[model samples]
Target: MAAPPGCFVGWQPLLLLAVLVVLQGQQLRADFGLPTAVMGGNLVVRDANGINGVLNAMDRAFRRFNPTGQTDRLMQASAVISQIALNVTELGRSVAGSVIKAASDRSTPVDELFAKLQEKYGRMSRYLDSEVQNAIETLNKSIGSAQSLSLKNALNSVAAAVRQITNSTADVGSVIARIHETTSGNTIFKAVDKASIPADLTTSLSRALSNTKDQLTGLSRTIEGMLKNIGTTNAFLARFDQTRQATEKNIVGNQQGVKAFIDGEKDTTVKRYTNTRNAIIADISNAVGKLNVFGTNQTLLALYDKHSEEYTKIYYYLFNRNESDIQNISSAFDAIGHNMEKIVVDSTRSVNSEICYNKYSGQVINTFPGYQNGVVNCMTREKNRLGRITDVMDRMLQLILSTSQDLANNVASCTVWNGFDKSETVYRQAEACLHTNINEMAKFGSIIGRELDLVQTLGDVEVAASRYRLYDCVAARNNEALATIYVLNKDIDGCVSEPGLQRDVLGGGEKGGDEDTEDPYEAGASTTEEPVYDEYLMEVFSNSSSFGDDVDKIM
Candidate 1:
């Protein structure tokens, strides 16, 4: 009943037994299958986590990397541009001030001219006074004469003629002074006051008084003609006042209009530029923040594998957004371009207005002095004529007053000074000074025009520089963003291709099971063979072993 040495009675057939053991091993391996899925899931999850982490890291790096430093540098450059623009503006202001001062300096000549006019008017006043006195004396002498009837008629005619001349002289003097006052700041008054009067008024007044010796010159033709001349002079004076008033009013109105335009332009232009620059800075900040948030290696890797499509979409979206921001920046620059055009137009208007004012001033300055001189000369001639008449009357009157102590002491001994000659000389000198000032004012105006042109050119250059500098910075930022997008896309693609990610996340296929093998007893030749051990190795193994006999036996 004992089993053979290599076989037992309870043992099954070799093939069946081998198959059973192999199946058992297969079952054991199968028992670990869920763990494999878990491990695979862990690998996929790690891959996703790693990708996300890398992307986040990259994003952090990008965000942390400050481009603001470059932006600050650009801003500094803008400040430099602003400084240049300010310099140009200041230059323009300086030129304008200089020109204005030059124009005002012409007032010196104008003042001198006015003085000459006053002197001429004074001489005429004195002449009229003397003529009135002479007429009174003549009338008195006639009344005392024995040829009373004829003498009375002659005295009356002389008296009437004298009154008419005095009246006309008074009217002329009043009109001339008013005209001079109205154009006081003008140079022409000096020249006119200095020059000689024309023959017409002198000849007419002389003739009118000459015939007055016969029957009280009944409103003589000469006096009437002199009155007509006075009327003509008054008309000219009125016209001169009107012209100056109108010019001044126009200049004031134009200056106000230009000031309003310039203020509006500055406000609008500065607001537009500031708003645009702020908007651009805000957009750049946002875009950069976004880049920082999503540009990490981990996130890019995760996006590369699991969400490549989304990654691509986001990348392009950011790119397009940045491009849109750049376009907006360009539009802002376009607004600045419009501002530049407005400034140029305003500058042109200002220059033109200044030039126009200067031209009008020059014309007024040139003409008024001569007009004043002529009026003065007229007054002077009238004065001289009246003086001769007054001189004759004074001699006759002196005979009457020779007995009075006060008359003898003050009036007789005192010289009758004529102011006409002195006034004429002053008028001439003043007129000369006015001429010089007018010429200088014209030169200053020309210089101002040139300075304005230079300022405008400098302003244009500054605007161009500002626009170009901003454009360069924006373009550079846009290019950088685009490059980042490209890099992120590549990283996402690589992550998507990894085998670890494909197997676990994609659920493509299961792993192979453990294989079966032949039964050891059936395949072996000997069942009782012992493994050999060396005694020296056994002693060394025994001395070092904690499980003494078993380890020693195995050795």
Candidate 2:
């Protein structure tokens, strides 16, 4: 007697048996190492035939469904469908993973197969007789549902449009009513005697009344037509109320979201930047103070004094009785003054006499070869040097005196009086005062920047809220219209499936049956015939496995 067709004999059975044994071991481990040898034996006896039968049935079904002549086409189609399903599943999984990652630091992998099932087959497929056929049916149903939703949405949209028209009409009516009330209340019309009224005025008033009456009549007709088309005004109002409620809810939610986002940004990013800016300002203030101290250092003051003395001597030599020396010195003095003017202007300071003297003294010492040569020209080098020095000294002294006079004038003319102090002390106090003012300005700038940022954030929030409110109304109306469209599509689909349309398309009875009997797959049979799968699957599977391993290690 021959063994049953599905009975496994060699390494195949052994491999299956090994897998079963491993599963049994896992089960035993799960059960706290309970003695499961007898249970394993029972599993083998109970499941072996059923497993073999299922495998055989799968093979037979594949052979029947996928014939040799059409294997490639069917396989390619299946692969494409599977690929699409996988891609959709992966997209859903990624979305879910992103949501989860945002909520928690953990990465969770959703089952691709489950996601595919949900996306392709839907919940109704599980109860259907054939999963594939039910999948098709579910697709049809979903299309129907979508169509119904679209029809409903369209109706709602029309209703909304009608409501808008009605509102416009009401507004026009209110305007007309106001005009009528105003005209009726006017005492001029009542006081004017019919016989005594000017003919031109009476004619003008009658013409205006006629025009107004004509406009009101046209408006009334238009309102009546709109009301008839969109059902009663009361019905439109009821639908508008529903739409308004939905819109309000959506607007509130969006407003809250915008508020939360603004609050979070202000607390985190804005505040951090503000603090950093404040700290920078404080550091800058300290740096400015250090610069002021350096500017007034003893070494700097000594350098300035030497330069001043040289400048004073040069000035005295230029203005003395020697004619030849006077011309040369005057030209040098002018050049030095020009250069000093340039420096003071470049530094954004006024051309005060003290600044002029100091700057000219430095420039003369640096630029004049004659001053150095004269130092060596005299019989006694001391005399020539003394002469050069005295010339600079006289110029500097004149500049200093001029500067002093200006300062004294300014001080004496001032309304606010403080105790008298030395010039050096006053200069230091002025430097400190300038530094304080600069610090205050920087602080004010930082405060203003922060205030502007706050105002901008508030404006952004308000804009977002306003946009949300407007779009919410549009969305609510659109959703309702979508629902109406869905109903209309259902009606159309039902009409198509009815006996009349079905007979036209599918040949329900005997007429034109030959056309319907022809095979749909006949034309393409010769061109396509080979086992095929999507090339991308192998790569995807490898990548997925690697990713899974990495995740497992991390967990």
Candidate 3:
């Protein structure tokens, strides 16, 4: 017959065994001439023990039947809890060897069934705990990195590329105008070096192309090195992700196993514990019932049962809080851990604004420790790496600007030469202007070389050197163009000076002598002794737009 669901189907045979044990013990006490009332509790306990011994004998017999060569750990737990209640039920319901006979044809029952459930539980707690510790350590490290990182602020923000480049625009204005005049005046072919200008332009263009090619080669190498570092960072991120995913999978599967183990093991063990408790209650009731028998009254032994064939049987399960509460009582709890990752989120951004360019939510949690340590660790490391790159790149950008400004000053000296008229003596004026421009260009190069040599960020010095070669080639081309003009200007030195040029010198000029020729700040230190902002150095030249600002000690 099919047994009822959600009930112990083997309880029937176990109850019968318990009754037989009680009767046999009663008979033994009668033979010993002991009164039933005086021997009541002791007899029931003795009978229960004897019945448990029989059940252990069952364990030894069934051990050979189950192919698994190990004891059922859950059943073992049940067996230890007032063993009779636990063992009798398992033995009766077991579809293995018949209870009456086991060696008839040496065939066990089920006639056959899955037989791999006999192994006991192992120390899963130890493995899970070790993993948790590692995960937490990683989280702590990540948190620490985030907390300790430094970032830029208004105070620490030195002038970057934008500020540095624009500040020198005034200084180069004249140079830009000169380049325009030289190129445009070449239309007449009337300059002293008119015959040689074409060759000068060709040499300048050729050098520009060659310099560009060299810059491109250096740039390619720099890009390749950066790409390799990026690849390594990506690999590290992938490894971090893989470790997190594997840990999550293991933790999820272990949760399921733990749930199943508790539910299955509890089903049998709780029943055994409950039954033993009920039996003890019933035994006491029966002892009271013995006294009631003399008084001719109803007894509690008739109450602990739901199916008692006594004169009066009131079901305790119906009246007391027993099996009826099964639906209401929680036998299992599903774990739903809440990760409040807000702490990491809130603090990560607050540590340093420059470092917190993006939001980092370290929110992966297989368990509390996994989320707290491992996920936080991984995310923090990834974010911190990005912050570090931004810092390096920002510094690189600043260095590039400083370097570019230096090159611009060198190139601008020739490029921005203008405001001089195209007169017969224009060539002489061109040489004076060229002399001043070239002197400042050489000074810029000297300062730039010193500054660039001090910088070692990501091979920036090498990058700057390559870039300088390209700009220097441009400056060389300009020098050639200016030299052609200088030749023509010098040739006109023998030709009586034009009145138009003479008027420019007398009307739009400062009639200074040796002071104009000497660079007061040739040694590169300011008279005020205040540290010069390297970007601001270009502003101090006599030819610059800000020349009138402070022309005494440093101009």
Model 1 misplacement above 4 A: 1-227, 235-259, 291-457, 460-555
Q: Count the backbone clashes (under 3 Å) in each candidate.
A: 32, 37, 11
lDDT score, residue 345, model 1?
27
Which candidate should be chosen as best, given TM-score against the real structure? 3
Per-model TM-score, in order, reads 0.17, 0.16, 0.22
Which is the leading candidate under lDDT?
Answer: 1
Local lDDT at 513 for model 2: 29
Taken over the whole model, the C-alpha lDDT of each candidate is 0.30, 0.29, 0.28
For candidate 3, lDDT tens digit of each residue in 61-118? 3332221211132122112221322332243223122211211212222112111111
Residue 139 of model 2 has an lDDT of 25
Model 1 residue-pair collision total: 32
lDDT of 1: 0.30
Evaluation by lDDT, superior candidate among 2 and 3: 2
lDDT of 1 by residue, 117-211 (tens): 33433443343334334433332231111112222243245445445434433333343345445544542333343122233333333333333
